[model samples]
Target: MSTLIGKTALVTGASRGIGRAIAARLAAEGALVAVHYGSNKAAADETVAAIQAAGGRAFAVGADFGTEGDIDALLTGLDAGLGGTGLDILVNNAALAGGTDLENSTPDYFDRMFAVNVKAPFFLIQRLLPNMRDGGRVINVSSGVTRIALPETVYAMTKGAVETMSRNLANSYATGKRGITVNTVAPGPVDTGHPMFQIPEVVEGTAKATALDRMGEPEDIAAAVAFLASDDARWITGNTVDATGGMFLGPRF
Candidate 1:
């Protein structure tokens, strides 16, 4: 279980949902985790406390994405938490989702979506590259919307950009020289305690739409992330590990 002992990780958006689960899982694996939150100190603290309560090491770091000085703030907090240690894993799991369909999508909305989902992660990797040790892991959390036709056009586009960024990084000279592995994890309709998941119809429909005949959970996605962060996935890079429970894998006849 201590596959990551002596390693350090930073999971963005670790305040709740999939990010929180990923943070906890990394900590459980014996990694010193820095739980990053976007303007939610209370939730971040709760995540850190849960990890500590589980006999894992974790600390909270806050930086609201898509704003000025966000990366600087994040680096400051992350550096403080690491205490001179280099990072081994960086999970770009934070994003702004939902309500970006064609009719509702505005210029501002589209720009912001790209800003948070694409630009932030790109720059983060750039800035954090120096602080990350060789053979480090960079797992970008993307959505299956890149493959599935979804109403959230803008949102999907942003994720598409993320996938591209990940692949490029995986093959880039920087990562190649440092032995860093970059990959993406795409989840399909995971139940992250959103209100929509509370509706029986929504749950049933989503479950039936998947080949697994069940709805996906945040933990499901987190498990995949943990694997990629581990040394076992050292040879796996420039790939999208689908954590969607076989969603939309043809009609179940």
Candidate 2:
């Protein structure tokens, strides 16, 4: 649990759901975590408070993706919170999820989706690389929808781009002198305390979709991120770890 002692990590969109879980897990491993939120300081504060309560170090940072100067705002807060320390881990988990299909996928929707999902992470990595410590870790959160057929076509496309970017950067940016490791974690149907999970039918269907025969939890994905951020995954890079519980792994027939 102390694998991350003296490390500093910034987890974007960590106000709730999988992001929040990742923030907590990293803190528990002895890292000073920055819980990032788009528009919810209270939720981010809650995450930080929980980490502090558990005897871990954490703070809240706010910056809305897809807006003007989002990355600048995020970096400013990060720089202040870290107090001149270099970052050891970066988890790009913030995203705009759901509701973009072929019919409703207008130009505005497409731009916004790419802005938050694709553009934000890319620039974040590029801008943070200088301030990031050598041998650091960069873990990007993707989705199982990239592989499976889903109504959120635009959303899936963004994730596919993420996978490709991760692989490219893993080889070009993180290798050799840098020694940093870049990887992606794609989660399946996760129950992130959403109201939809309250429906029995939704839960049952999602459970049946996976080989594990259960809906995934936020903690499940968090565990995967924690593993990638640790020294244990040093040899592993430019890969997408499917933390999907075997979803869409062929028919049960």
Candidate 3:
């Protein structure tokens, strides 16, 4: 974990769930973390306090990622937080989830989904890359839904786009002198306090869906992102690391 000492990381949606876990993990590794949140200042503050309590450095930044001028606002906050330091890790973990099937999906809903899940990360990276130091890392948080059939067609499509972007960006940005690493971590059936998990049946079904016979925790996904963000993963790029607990490994039979 000391490998990240003196490095700096930015994690979007770090107010809760997997993003929160990732921020904590990175901070534990000795990186100064900038925790980004959409509209939850209290949650974001809590995250920062927790990191500091654990002998780590962290700060919270707020910006509604799907709205107009979102990238500008995020950069404004991040610049203030970072001072003159360059970014060493960028985690695109914020996204809009939960969309209906094609028949029920609306144009507005679809656009919003893309705005946060796809467009936001795309432009955010475009703006952040200038500040990212050589040998930095870009980690996109995708979903297992992209590899399996799901009712949330719009949401799945958005993740698919992120996976593609991860590959393409790794190729385009990770040049000889740059050495940047870009990758995606796709998690499956994570227990993130979503309302849908309140139902006992849904919980049971999700647990059984994985070959491990247990739903994933936010730390599970965070561990994967931590690896990709570290110097140990210098050779690994343009890849999707499946953090799905063997979900969709094949029929149960």
State the RMSD for candidate 2.
1.0
Q: Between prediction 1 and prediction 3, which has the larger TM-score?
A: 1
lDDT of 2 at 153: 94
Candidate 3 regions off by >4 Å? 173-176
Q: What residue runs in model 2 are displaced by over 4 Å at the alpha carbon? A: 173-175
Model 2 over residues 1-253: C-alpha lDDT tens digits?
Answer: 7999999999999999999999999999999999999999999999999999999999998999999999999999999999999999999999999676899889998999999999999999999997689889999999999888899999999999999999999989444358899999999989998899999999999999899999999999999999999999988999999999999899997
Displacement of the residue 249 alpha carbon in candidate 2, Å: 0.2
Model 3 residue-pair collision total:
0
TM-score of each: 0.98, 0.98, 0.96
The models' CA-based lDDT, in order, is: 0.93, 0.94, 0.92
Residue lDDT tens for model 1, 1-253: 9999999999999999999999999999999999999988999999999999999999999998999999999999999989999999999999998666799888999888888999999999999998799999999999989999989899998999999999999999999888899999999988889999999999999999888888998899999999999999999999999888888889677
Candidate 1, 211: how far from true, in Å?
A: 0.9
- Score candidate 3 by lDDT: 0.92
Candidate 3, residues 1-253, lDDT tens digits: the string is: 5769999999999999999999999999999999999999999999999999999999999999888889999999988899989999999999987759989999999989999999999998888887689999999999999898889999999999999999999888333259888999999888899888878999888878889888899999999999999888999999999999998788998
Candidate 1 global lDDT: 0.93
Better of 1 and 3 by lDDT: 1
User: What's model 2's lDDT at 27?
Assistant: 96
